[model samples]
Target: MGVFRIGFFNIFIYLCCAFLYSVPNVCGHNNMCFDCIDLEGCKAPKHFLKYMSAVDRDKVVLRLPTDKPDPMMDRCLNTGYTIKATLNGTVCSGSSDGLCHAIGEATTNFTITYSHCGDCYIACDCYSQENGNARKEGPIILTMCLAAFYTLIQ
Candidate 1:
């Protein structure tokens, strides 16, 4: 009985790993290369967050990388950040205007200065089916799978 149980667990682990590998993720890189919008320097390329304060209001500091500008990029959903820098374990504090905000799903879309990105902008709301809310799916899937596996083991 014990040997059969051990074999079952081993087979289960192998299947789980295979399933994970079957899913491809664009998160292994540091940037998201969208046709309209662009971002770079995300410490967690896979878990690029769209909104954080919603998840944690009073979260004045967000752990994210800065933005990389493109010449053809024409709109701003959330723009005009007073300051922008890589949060490489560094903390930042400041006031944000009506336009400046930490809102999104995967990676943070923040403005740097008034020159390129100004205040009072909108339309950062478009999401592709392939890339939209899928940013939040990986962790959720893994968590659920692990939970189920734990229960099975028990």
Candidate 2:
């Protein structure tokens, strides 16, 4: 009976380790949004005002922790870029080298992961372009026209 109990404990430990390592890193994920700091007040360029659409808070699963210090800075080179993340319902922002972690209770630093560990946000600057991000659900007429134009040229 004792031997069986010991084996079960070992199996539980193995399963826990496997689950912990399976989480995806958030910063490296391929999601982007408007570059503007103020979503409600920022206006898109008029070039294709038709191409513009309201920011979808629905898709903003991760609240960019812009109000706090960035936690992803590369300590080795002392070089980092500003980024955002959320911890325990509070927004935290700080310098990061394209990666970050959430500092929680008792000095527990949890690695930022996609959808599970903490909320991660990506703004326009993260993708290196102007506010070029537009919703696929934007004006279908304009989107269809653009698609048609590309097809004809190709």
* Candidate 2 structure quality by residue, lDDT tens digits, 64-144: 345333233222011322222212221222222222222111222333223211232232122323234554435776989
Model 1 lDDT per residue over 64-124, tens place: 3464432211121222221121221211111111222222222444433221111111222
Q: Per-prediction count of colliding residue pairs?
A: 9, 9
Number of the top-ranking candidate, with lDDT as the measure: 1
Worst-scoring 10-residue span by lDDT in model 2: 44-53
Q: TM-score of predicted model 1?
A: 0.19
- On the 0 to 100 scale, the lDDT of residue 98 in model 1 is 20
| Candidate 1 displacement at residue 88 in angstroms | 22
The numbered model that scores best in TM-score is 2
Error of 1 at 133 (Å): 34
**Sequence-dependent TM-score of model 2:** 0.23
Q: In candidate 1, how many clashes are counted? A: 9
